[model samples]
Target: MNYDQLMFNINAYKENNQILDLAKFLVYEFELDHPNLEGFGFRDELEKNSILLTANGDIGERQMVLIPRNLFDFEFNLVINMIAHEMLHVRQKSPEMMLEDKNEREWQAYYEMLFHTNFPNVPDVSDYHKKFFAEKALEYYRRMGEGSELQAKYADQKLKVLSLIDNIQHNQA
Candidate 1:
């Protein structure tokens, strides 16, 4: 994932009809915006950021999505997932309101991450990080939505998912 190769992929995405296909993928399946993502650039690597959308210009309802090339190593399925995440942000008419509810926002992200990870195909990706990517996060979200204790539910679910994965991964290791 050098700089040149990253640009190559971005260019290839356009030339090979991949960009259009990915844009359609969002529209058809996720009800997300079909982005006109042009090019990526180098930006300060905030430790927590893997990918983010910085708007360059407006094209009707959508803006040109500028990415950070060095932030992530490019993989086809993974890159699609990353773009999909940002598309979620773009689709939000009031992202500031969404951001106000920390639990709901994280719950939605984690809930969606499970789909992107393809738990069956890459189960091990979350084996040691169940709290971040497992059913427990979803369960916590559900309980919190039910008017239960927030922090307690989160704590309980995080450890629960981790423990569940530990049990499942034990002998197979």
Candidate 2:
């Protein structure tokens, strides 16, 4: 999609009091297909810095993306990227799955958040943010070295994350 067109459309949604529509549009545009993908809306109680998509841990519950009520405080692009990050979490769940490694989940989510083409604008991923991601990447790397089949399977992603970390560390701004 064209960056200018996307931004203009998002702004229109923002002005029309249809931010939830914007979120739904993003979910569809991102092609986040899941039977449990309920819908998107705001939550007053959600913390300011977080946009979360939650899966129902119990039966009969549903999955939904909860945006902060103070949505106007965040940049539209960043907010979309954050929602995409949470939706990535939504896509990771299963009906009866084992607890997955937190580092692995986070690294994968972060990779998609920063690199996905559906998001035309990438907000500044701060040095602090990179450090946090680097720790997760290193832990995943450690798991790979220890012969974790699951981690080993993501070796290509591991290398990419480490390469990004290396590039950023050496070329500090």
Candidate 3:
């Protein structure tokens, strides 16, 4: 589907006037440079608990991102965060860069997200959210099976991302 259709779905899922406004704000925030980029919406049953941002190949071709509808049920800020995070991934795809450095790639995306958005100033991330991400990563690993090296790679990347988030929060404090 197109970006507008995807946005409509997200807006429909929003629960309140404040959330609608937040969603609008996020859309405006993303639109500042988003028109030049190529993006499409795809349903991700597997990633129902998480959002993903991926860029394939150089020349900045093949940009794809998915956001979970369930996340919209949590907080409007989260929806904005997920979308913004994925947009950063779209920006990171370089034709010259090798794809093997998964952790490095994720670190770059996380840094981009932090740099682009006004992340909340909370010193410590809630245990609930931490456990949620951990569990989501574990579930992904299980689905990928032990034979898949990608699963292990993702796990390592996830750990690094979590650590980076912690560092950002600590530094902010």
Which ranking of candidates, highest TM-score first? 2, 3, 1
TM-score of 1: 0.42
True-structure RMSD, every candidate: 8.5, 4.4, 9.4
Task: State the C-alpha lDDT per candidate.
Answer: 0.47, 0.63, 0.48
Report lDDT (Cα) of residue 106, candidate 1: 54
In terms of lDDT, the poorest run of 10 residues in model 1 is: 117-126
> Residue 9 error for model 2, in Å?
2.0
Cα RMSD (Å) between model 2 and the true structure? Answer: 4.4
lDDT per residue (tens digit) for residues 45-132 in model 3: 4555554434433434645454433446554445555565555555555343334444444544444343443333212334444444
Better of 1 and 3 by TM-score: 3
Kindly give the stretch of ten consecutive residues in candidate 3 with the minimal lDDT sum. Answer: 116-125
- Cα distance off (Å), candidate 3, residue 152: 23
The TM-scores, one per candidate, come to 0.42, 0.66, 0.44
